[model samples]
Target: MAEVRTKSGEPAKTAETKRPKRADALRNIEAIIDAATRMLAVDADASLNDIAKGAGVGRITLYGHFDSRAALLRAVADRAIAQSDRQLATLDLEGDPRAALARLLEASWELTHRYGALVIAASQALSPEQLQRVHDEPAARVRALLERGRAAGAFRDDTPIEWQVTVIQAILHGASTAVYRGEIAAEDAPGLVRDTALAALR
Candidate 1:
């Protein structure tokens, strides 16, 4: 029997051998993503050159990790979404649906405010299907909470649950915009979002 060999007539590389050098590469990737997140949050049209500089990396280094601005933006949005998921998962959402929602809103608002216009950048870069999948988990959390609230008579059941979820998302997005435009104080957005959503549900 003949043994298989690589194109170079050497044994195929093992998984461990194929692994990229970790420390520096990981640090550079994280730095680039962090910088992209910060810059994109402030300006959806923030240039890639600016982001690379903010990351303390040369343009070549940024391009080495992320092929294009869209790729980097996707990475930044993914990290933000993952962090938001972990934070939301920690909340006690078992009782008093309204109170639970208020807690959720407070946390969600913090994330929304932190990420700001990054969502707009992501929407423009990612396809709608990709964006929807990214939001699925967080949206499911709200949908589940709404189902509970409606079942317990804590929230109105007149509208579709999906519509309610859309409204909640809109309110959060609008609040973020309001803060950016100086129409509403950031400190007051949580309470206002909570009140507005709860009232709308009723």
Candidate 2:
């Protein structure tokens, strides 16, 4: 996604600051976030009113949880990453480096495809710095795996580990774009991403 600078304006409440205290309020917050995720996944330009309606809540209720569209998008992106990280954590990443990498790529491709549109929306709504911070954990997971692979001589070490990580991310993003454009079938993406990334690493 292209880096889109966040506009300067009055500082809005952070997600933490606006977090709900009561059980019912928390439920409402969860509903709004769920609605936002589903809506934004289809349309990056999905409006706050639409999201609120989808959540079965009113605009005032949505605003009570999220101060603005950007704030809501950030929450949606954060939720997606959290869910992705949880699912990825369950994978057995403990075999030959190449095999482990393939497993990771397959799981990563699923998450990337699921969150592709939300990523685009966040790119438009969040600052570069915010986006980087949001992605840090997921990127670190890949970087650590690459470091292990390179140390084992399964992946190339001639290039920096960071560069290799970037290549992997780029390939996954490209696969997402290709599927979206009908250039490739969604069901075929995991194997394609795995083979393509492994070849590039080698």
Candidate 3:
């Protein structure tokens, strides 16, 4: 007869030792992330312990999943980025590149208005390499749209692609600041973005 002994100090294989259902684990992860988001929305300085409590999970459970506050914030930023990605994916850029660039700016302005602080925090916290991984790919897609516009002669042929991208990004930051400072009307955002982008092209 073979000896019946557990390996190391752990219990032997048993039905109870099996992993939780995948859906259940996912639910926990989502719940924790949601809790963190809610906390951050009201106060970006909310404590992790409080967040875990709000999520109805123990501190250990939170750590088991995220390991650190930065990791948790990265997860939250990824969620926000996913939302922006969906919004950007639907833009129609076919007929004219300049018009398309204007439309993209308007779309981006709205997204930044909705999640500016979250985006700013991510930019401030992440290392350059990590930030590039999340932000650069989407940025490149936007740059390609500009390139398309330049090719169509919607923008000045002499304008560098990089300069156009930089100007658009700068305008977005300025718009967000203006909105936060109550210096710009949200209703005027579309026209303002269009005018600013066109001015850059000229």
Best by TM-score: 1
Best prediction by lDDT = 1
Q: Residue 34: error of model 3 in Å?
A: 2.7
TM-score for each of the candidates: 0.85, 0.82, 0.75
- Ranking of all candidate structures by their lDDT, best first: 1, 2, 3
Q: Which ten residues in a row have the lowest lDDT in candidate 1?
A: 1-10
Each prediction's whole-model lDDT (CA)? 0.84, 0.83, 0.73
Per-structure clash totals for the candidates: 0, 0, 0
Residue ranges of candidate 2 with Cα displaced over 4 Å: 1-21
RMSD of 1: 5.8
- lDDT (Cα, 0-100) at 26 in candidate 1: 74
Per-residue lDDT over 3-54 for candidate 2, one digit per residue giving the tens place of the 0 to 100 score: 1112112255543444343445668878998998888888888899999999
Instruction: Give candidates' CA RMSD values in order.
Output: 5.8, 7.1, 6.9
